[model samples]
Target: MGCSHLVIQRDFAAFFLHFFYQSWMLYPENESTIVSWIWIGIGILFLTTAFIILLVTHYFEQIRKNKRKMIQLVRNAETECWESIHYLQERDRERLSEELHDNIISQLNIIRLNINTRNGKELNSDLKRSMQLVRELSHNLTPPDLNGIELSDFISDYLVQISKEVEVLYVNHTEQDILISGTIKLNLFRIVQELITNILKHAFATEITVLLRVSVKYLSLVVKDNGRGFPMEKYNKGIGMKNIQSRSRKINAVYKFKTKPEKGTRCIVFLTLNNTKI
Candidate 1:
């Protein structure tokens, strides 16, 4: 904007200089009255000022149009992300249905048979497994804590649910538990979930580390994996990353990713905590 303004001023300066020269040439040196020259000068000045104002206004309008265009692009991207999120929700429902029928129902039926046969040990074993399955399903539906307190513990619990397949470690560095709004907590949870899902699905890494830090003024989350990192330009444009981007913006957070092929990846999220409940 500044460059455009400067160029306009420079061009206008030259154009006005030539215009005044031509106007001066219109009158002979002695024949031109002082009042007439003054009038001519005032007219030139007025036109120059008006043209500058017009240029400034035009530049401002262009800026507004660009801003609107950018907002529309974001809206379109977010709309696409919601479609992906909905697809994920549908898949979760299908998986839950299958687990209920194939695992819990079948296990319960076996326990019933064992009880009928007076098999106490077998019945106890089946009951334990059934309880575990139910707990897992419950966790999948809702996070461990709904109040948005104890975010580290919530993340720890989530990791537990997925740790059996791969090694996962979590560390909390905050001196006190952080109380965040439900909106922040839920978005962070989804972001964390998406990062881990990507690692598990594609990274093939056996070690995952999550670090949580909350201070009086700000909070940060770090998720790192020792898996094969992806190309920044290629893989970072996926719906998962775009979803994270939108969520980051919604919460006024900064989301950054550092990665390289075979070098592993680290994701960082930082946000101010001024609005957070103590």
Candidate 2:
């Protein structure tokens, strides 16, 4: 490398001297002064060209760096905003859970006891059904036990419970020991929840399926529904879909979807456990 650089410098110097000699020879009568001005002009042009190139390169680099930073900043802001929203939702759910457990459940029990004593069996049965609905609502807000639980198991149980409302089928090809960081797990779980919620809200289908598969390099989850699907271009570009995409991107996961009207909607989420740039 040193020898190559030395040779480059030598060649440049020889070219410079040759160019100067020729320019001076063209104006040999007053060659010295004219040659000086020509050399100065040549030098200025070289410096100006160098400066322009450097400015352009610097501007391009700055633009690239600013674009990257802006993207990162927007993503971070999105994450924080979602977190705050989740926190608020959880807070509201917690409050609702407490009200259900404390006020509504207690009042329903009292009503049940009062009716059991005063009214016939029909009234008591009605009270029991109302109490049951309250209990279901409470459970839906906050999971009973999640501490030290594997997310796969938690999700499995969740789907089974959801299956009671609408059919849910789980196809598992995962090795079962693929544990992830808590934050990653949380984000993924929320994504699953969001997809499931979307299906419940929109898909008037009889059955939905969630598939999990994992390999040494990647973990993938596929959620599909046998519903009256929407136009692929329409729904996939909707707000909910965009939100899912954003959350998936935060975890460096690849998100894809396939859908056909009157057919079904299928979403594939793939994540790498290691911090490998996508």
Candidate 3:
């Protein structure tokens, strides 16, 4: 009975050893496969995280670049405004000096000469003409009282005066009164005057069309002429054109000139009324 018990115990021991060896052999392959899969998952997660970070960084960089461009554009516009103001001021000074020298001073000198001659009739005539000239100059320098007058009416009267020299057409598109400062009106009038003067002096044009449009948010003035158009390059080099551009900047208006040889010239000015100085 002792021998039979020993044989049974040995057999049980061998079966247990065989089962343990098989389990160990299978464990190595399964463990290796699981480890490889875990590593691959970790690598994929790391790559995805890195890609997300890169995308976020690029988006912020693009935003920063756009902001910088906007800032630069604003700075450039401000610089142009200041330069235009300075140029217009200087031009005005020069104009005043010319008017004094050519009109007032010269007329005074002529009156003085006539007085010394003691010709009553001629002196009377000269004095009257000189007075009239002075009045006109004063009117030119001073802004007319616009308390009861519409801007369109004023412009219409002005066009009528010029119509004798050239065919003039004026059109008004807005019924409501344009609410703007007196200074702005005066500047705009001066700009129109300058343009007309240029057309008369250089364009040799017989017909001119002026259009004025006022809306809730903006005002537009357009001057078109059927004349011998000058080259834009030549126009830019002239002081008169520069003066026009300067005035436009002073009013914070956008000015565009379209011209070609023998075709015609068109000048368009756009002024924003909303939240603007005008």
What overall lDDT, based on C-alpha atoms, would model 2 receive against the true structure?
A: 0.68
Candidate RMSDs in order: 15.8, 14.8, 17.1
Question: Which lDDT value does model 3 have at 152?
Answer: 72
lDDT of 3 at 22: 70
TM-score of each: 0.49, 0.46, 0.51
Report the lDDT of model 2 for residue 200: 66
- C-alpha lDDT (0 to 100) for residue 261 of candidate 2: 75
Best by lDDT: 1
- Score residue 134 of candidate 2 by CA lDDT: 71
CA lDDT of each prediction against the hidden true structure = 0.74, 0.68, 0.71
**Which residue pairs come into collision in candidate 2?**
none
Report the Cα lDDT for candidate 1: 0.74
lDDT of each residue in 195-245, candidate 1, tens digit only: 777776678788999999987778899999999998888766776676677
Which lDDT tens digits does candidate 2 get at residues 68-152?
9999999999999999999999878644644444334433543433452445665566566666657766566443334466668
Q: Residue 29's C-alpha lDDT in candidate 1?
A: 71
Q: State the displacement of the C-alpha of residue 199, model 2, in Å, after optimal TM-score superposition.
A: 1.2
Give lDDT: candidate 2, residue 147: 44
Give candidate 3's error at residue 169 in angstroms.
1.3
